[model samples]
Target: MIRLRAHHLLCLLTYVGRGYTPAFVAQYSAIVARLNAGEGAVLVEGPDDICAPMLDSGHHCREPRITTRDALAREAVAAALGQSLAPGDTIPLDGPTIARLRENFAAGTIRAACAACQWDGLCSGIAASGFSRTRLSGAPV
Candidate 1:
């Protein structure tokens, strides 16, 4: 496996969050191969290839701009929250929080709640309750 930089991971994470298909990896791989073939300074044809590090680093840098910005925002939020984050496997909620979340789910407020929730897409319970695409990445703690 090629060593991925922070920016590369950020790109992949952003695409995953946007609900892109799993085929994205293949596409990125092809782009990487092209980049490795002395085409590092070339440009990609679309936003679909934004997660490619070489593409982002060169003339085809436009597509990855938004992805990069989102990654930065995510990083800032993560820093503010600090490490040792609660895993999505367990939704940590007191009785009141659970009730409120359930109520929100019943009232079609899952989007609002998910927007406010850091766990968002990571939580299977939350995702099943509503909103599928919450966070961008699935890095295990």
Candidate 2:
């Protein structure tokens, strides 16, 4: 299973082969491929697989603001999916599920956690463009 922070579930909706570093992009791209191939995702509190590449660089994965973002993301996503999600909860990255999440993301209903995120504008652009060129499979074509 791929380990991911709750906020990453929102991030995946707009990933377009860009990231903080080449290694970060590469790692995230590979994770997206795995998710496309039907990998399961396990929710993690902080510093998940995607954050591994940045850990050595003193990344802010452990910061309080990021932790709060995670909590907000978890709450919003759980409400969107109508499921209770915890740190250890496993989420299936299936086509329908991804589609549903993307729909909610584009509608701005599940975006409270993204308010303070640096990539919010980028994500909003992606959503506005109908998720075009996003790496995630099962996105609207």
Candidate 3:
């Protein structure tokens, strides 16, 4: 289960698996493994090893990260909407505010977790096309 932000949820919706490096792919595959059971979403939670962090530029994926981006997500969203996601458990990527989040991202208010991801453009394109309408292949959210 990978904990995710609006950015990651959108990226996975448009992901075609070509931009990241082999190391990144290998690391990502570990997360993909969880999808076999058909459990995937922007926000997810699973067994320890399978529950990958929202992989960011901060991750080289060669070692354990001493810090997590939970605060970054809280700050970004709270700064934008004055409320933060609790994400108590795995959350499938489906909601009414997908477009609102996208708009915030474009305005630079909802960008912390995604500022460094290479898939930024793709996610933006997907969002631009209408985030609430976009859907991932494996799950409704």
Candidate 4:
């Protein structure tokens, strides 16, 4: 269990070796639990990895290019995560819903990626309000 950003989980398959910290395990376990609990996970295919063997594995792959919209969404999520907001925070403890957003960011699937999400509307609304990187440093997303 690694305390990694959602992007790491999207791109990395293996959870490396021993002496894992409790926090790391908790964080990652939460993600796995969410995935196993039937929450939808969006795993966009990396741009250059279109021909990569990992995608060919046919396990958890989708072919979609990342885009500016996705980049904004990912940035927002990162901002929120940086705040380490609890379940009751203004941002709902929406579970591991961010996996796909991270994937979309990596794969260049900006526009069509978030069609299935409740937060899709929010993302657009926020970006429209001039969601800036500086605000990410000042407060949580």
Candidate lDDT scores, in order, read 0.35, 0.90, 0.47, 0.35
Each prediction's TM-score versus the true structure: 0.24, 0.95, 0.44, 0.23
For candidate 4, write residues 63-105 as lDDT tens digits: 3333433444445454544644221223322334344333343
Determine which window of 10 residues in candidate 2 has minimal summed lDDT: 132-141
How many clashes does each candidate structure show, in the order listed?
0, 0, 1, 8
User: Which has the higher lDDT value, candidate number 2 or candidate number 3?
Assistant: 2
Q: Model 4 scores what on Cα lDDT?
A: 0.35
Model 4 misplaced regions, further than 4 Å:
1-109, 132-135, 138-141
Q: Candidate 1: global Cα-lDDT? A: 0.35
Task: Name the candidate that leads on lDDT.
Answer: 2
Residue 4's lDDT within candidate 2 is 96
Predicted structure 2: lDDT:
0.90
lDDT of 3 by residue, 1-141 (tens): 454533343344444443456755555455544553456444322222322343555444333221233445445655555554555535443333444455676665666666566667876776566544333334233
- Lowest summed lDDT over 10 consecutive residues: which window, candidate 4? 132-141
Compute the lDDT of residue 100 as modeled in candidate 1. Answer: 45
Q: Report clash pairs, candidate 1.
A: none
Candidate 1's TM-score reads 0.24
